[model samples]
Target: MEAEIITIGDELLIGQTVDTNSAYLGQKLGSIGISVSRKTAIRDNESAILQAIAESQSRCNILIITGGLGPTKDDITKKTLCKYFNCGMRRDLTVIDHLEKIFAERGRQLLETNLVQADLPETCITLQNNVGTAPGMWFDQNNKILISLPGVPVEVYHLIEESILPKLQETLQLPIVEHRTLVTLQKAESLLSKDLEEFENTLPKSLSLAYLPNFNMVKLRLSQKANVASDLIIDEYFDKLIATIHDDVFCLGDKDPATHLSEHLIREGITFTTAESCTGGFIANRLMQTPGISSVFPGSIVCYSNDVKISELGVDPNIIETYGAVSEPCALAMANGVREKFNTQLSIATTGIAGPDGGTKEKPVGLVYIAVSTESQSICKKFRLFGNREQIIQRSSNAAIWMAKQVLTIPL
Candidate 1:
């Protein structure tokens, strides 16, 4: 089934708040074989809401909306829905009773304004929100289903899982959509695509391929429509495709790079530390972002200045004078020093000239060296990334992580 998501908020339009609801809803719907055709974010104005709903209903069978549902006066979604559906509001006594009980249990006074939440469009089906004050509303008009959910992420997620998805499954007959993502590093998107040209061309008619490139890696997503019970065919095709790009592949699931690295390190019981320069603490931050990562990530040292590199990571002054800070020798020294200082199983280091300036004839901008030190050996590689400061730093960080993964002897 095709779907459209509308996120309604003045904050979203003004960049005061990010509309993360659409992305989450899209992923959830896609898992159930529903494709999200478009996602729109509108202001709190009723005209904008009406236009968005009308546009969505014309093209999609399912329309999911979030935001403008609150006890405050700025929340006008209920009134707009009533006007659009040509139905008057009716106070749902069951909802009012539940709201009152919740307020009593929470030891809070219920104002008449809060009672307004129990009033919903007469023609719509009122779905009880067990976790919050705002009730979810479901409406079916001319074969189109429009579901209005609270702006609160947790509450909306509960309603989707508890009510919307189950009802959708019973209402719609959906085709099976299978997707597989392969993550790889050490290659550009253009080069990888050229290398896989013949293999991509030979794919069956039902299968489609997409390249999602980011930082130092490219994600190849393979999607197919299942005509019957064709799991074996899909698996076989995926296996052959993986084998075709075996040398470049680093991960086999839909996980980000940090998660893949964290899982690998945890499996091996290997602890890691980092010494960073141009990448700052981005590598360390990403590694620690995952839960249960403290067991694998020991610590990180950010030496932005030459003096700090000498004092903190113990890089030699002579080495910096001779090979420069962004050189392979400096990167290797940083990696070895961090591993020894932290006494960790492995270490990753990055030193780069990430800049809009600071390019010399000898060393141009985007010159980076990443090193990985393990018990067996220390490996360093150089790269000339092309981008602004942010891009350069991100590319250097990604390269360092990839090198760390490689040095640890983690299976791709």
Candidate 2:
């Protein structure tokens, strides 16, 4: 079924609050074979909400509205929806009781505004909100399903999973949707697209490929919407894509490169650590995000300064003085030193000039050197990236992770 999401808030337009609800809703709806045709963010005004609802009803079968459902003056979504449906407000006793219990549990007084939150459109069915005071509304108008939800992320998540999805399944005949994502690095998006041109051309109408690129990595997602042989067909295409670029593929799923590396380190009982310079513990931070990584990854050294690089990671003072801190030799030494210091089987090191300043003609900004080391051998690569300081640091960290994966797969 076709769907559209309307995220209502002035904060989203002003960039004070990001509209993450649409992404979450789109993904959830897509998983149930519902395609999100369009997503729109509008100000928290009655006219805007009415216009958005009118436009969405013309285009889609399912319309989802999020935000502006709070117990305050600017909270107009519930009233707007009532006006659109030409219905008067009705105070739901059950919701009032729910609110009272919530307030009592929290040891807070229920104000008049909090009680007014229980009021709903007379024509719509109220969807219970277990996590919050605001209740979701479901309106079936002329066969088009309109669902209005609260703006809070956690509450929205629970409502969708616990109530909305189940209701959708009960009402609609949803096709089985299957998606396979392959994470890859070292290739630009244009180049990867050219390489996969033939594979994409051969894909059936039911199957679609989307390239989601971030930093230096690309996520190749293959989706299929059908009931019969969907998984088998998707897997067949997935294997073909992997075979075409097996070396670049990090893992055959949505998880990041750090996650796969951590899993491998844990499975093979290999220890790891990082010696970070310009990346400023970014490499270590990404690895630490993976759960239980502490078992294999003991710790890391973030030597941002020359003194710390010399003292903590034991890089030679002469190496920094001669070839400079951002050079390949310094990266290699840092990698080797960290591997030895942590007493680990593997280690990653990054050093670079991620800057808007402090760059020479010889060593420009985004000049990064990444090194991966084992007890027997050390490998370092030079990268001349282009971006702001944060972007350069992020790309450098991704490069380090990719290099670590490559080093672990190869024998010393």
Candidate 3:
């Protein structure tokens, strides 16, 4: 089945708030074999909302809309929906009761405006909102489904998961969909595509492959939608594909790069620390973002200034003077110093000129040096990255983590 998402709000159009709801819905729909054909973001004006709805209904079998469902007058989605369905607005007693109970329990007085939450289109089915006051509405017209949900993320998620998804599955018998993702590092997308050209061409008609690429890593996702049991065939193809990319493949399954690195460090009982300059603690922040990372990741230091690098990471002043703070020598010193200071089994370090400024003749902007240190050895390398300040910082941090992961894989 195909669906279109319409995310409505002045905030989204004005760039005040991001439309993350559509992305979440699209991914969930894709996993269930429902392709999201189009996504639109519009202001809360009636004309724009009507136009979006009409366009979506004309092109897709299902239309999912979120936003503009507040109790205030500016929230005109309910009124607009009533007009679109050619129906009158009626007060839903169940919704009113729920709203009253929630407000009473919280010791808040209900105002006239709050009563507007109970109004719904007469032609639609009201889906109970267990978590909020705005109930979801489902409309069926000409064998197409239209669902209107609250703008709040939590409310929309619960309605979709608890009510809408089950109803959709029952109404439409969908094919069994399965997907497997393989993660690899240190390879560009173009190079990987060239290497896998023949493998992709030989794939069965029932299966589809996509390459999702990011900094320093690529995810190979294989998807199949069919009624028959095709695990054996898919596995045979994936096994051959993995064999061709064995040297670069980092992990199997749909985990991120940090998850793989964290698992490896935890499994090997290796403690880790980072000393960052240009990356500005991004590497440490990413590692900390994953759960159970504290078991392996102790902490990190942001040594942005040359004085701090010399003092905190114990980099020699002479090395800084001779090779500069962004050089390989300083990077190696930072890695080894942090490993010793934290008594960690391994450590990573990054120093670079992430720029729109701070470029010299020899050391231009985006000149980064990354180092990884183990008990026995410390390795450092330089890179002339390309991008703005934030991108340069992000790329440098990813490169440092990738190096650390690579070093950890070496047999001691």
Candidate 4:
């Protein structure tokens, strides 16, 4: 089945709020064998909303409308929906009770405007919103399904997962669509594709591969929609793809580098820390984003200056004077020092000149040194990366994390 998304909001058009709901819906709907044909972002105007709904109804079987469902007068989605369906509004007692309970639990007053949120279009079925006040509306007309959900991302996500998906499955017969993604690092997308050229040629017509690249990482997603033989075909091809480029593969699913590193560290009971210079603690911040990382990551030291490196991370001042702060020696010293100071089993360090300025013939910009230290061994690598300041910093951070992971995980 094909679908179209209509995201209604003034904030989205003015760049005050990004239209992330469309992307989320498109991905989720695609996973259930529904393709998103188009996404339209419009202002919270009644005429525009009606026009978009009417235009989209002619194009697809499913229409997802999000936004303008709130307590304020500006939120006119329910009333506009009623006009479109030629029906009146009715107060749903169950929704009102749910809103009252939510307001009471939070010790907030239930104003008249808030209570009006329970009034939905009479012709549509109400989809319960466990996380928010505005419930979702599901309308089936002319053999098409139209679902209106609140603009709040969390509420939209909840309704989609709990109500919308199951309802769609129950109402329509969907094909089996599955995906297997491999996230690889330190390899450019073009090079990875060249390596997989023969493998791609051998794939069946039912399967397709897509490469998604960001910074220094690439995600290879294999999607298939077929019968019982699809699973075996995907499994066999996935194994072959991994075997073809095993050295570059960091993870088997669509997980970021930080998440993969954190899970590995926690599962192996490895305590970790970092000493960052040019990357400015980006690696540490990424790892910390993963929940339960506290058990494995003690802390990180952002030794951006020579003095901080010497005083906090205990990087030897002599090494900095002899080889400069962006040298391999300094990077290795920082890693070992942080490991000793924080009492961690593993440590990562980065030192680089990520800039549009600060380049010399001897030492240029984008020159980075990354080091990973363990109780048994210490390794350092120097790289002449190329990019703008932000991109250079991001690449350096990814390299440091990949280095640490490689040191910690030696593939048998």
Instruction: Give a tens-digit lDDT track for model 4, residues 1-412.
Output: 8999999989999999988888899889989889999999999899999999999998888999999999888888889999899999999999999999999999999999898999999999999999999999999988989999999999999999999999998999888888899888899999998999999999999889999998898999998886454354777788888899998998888888778888778878899999988889898999888888999887899998899999998888899999999899999999999999999999999998898998888889999999999999999999888989999988888888788866776331
Give the number of colliding residue pairs in candidate 2. 0
Off by over 4 Å in 4: 227-232, 410-412
Error of 1 at 62 (Å): 1.6
Q: Could you give candidate 3's per-residue lDDT for residues 288-397 as a string of tens digits?
A: 77677788777889999999998888999999999889899999999999999999999999998999999999999989999999998899988888889998887787
Which prediction has more favorable TM-score, 2 or 3?
A: 2
Weakest lDDT window of 10 consecutive positions for candidate 2: 403-412
Cα error, residue 279 of model 2, in Å, equals 0.6
The estimated TM-scores of all candidates read 0.92, 0.95, 0.94, 0.95
lDDT of model 2 at position 301: 94
Clashing pairs in 1: none
Question: What C-alpha lDDT, on a 0 to 100 scale, does residue 345 get in candidate 2?
Answer: 93
Cα RMSD (angstroms) for every candidate in the order listed: 2.2, 2.1, 2.2, 1.8
Order by lDDT, highest first? 4, 2, 1, 3
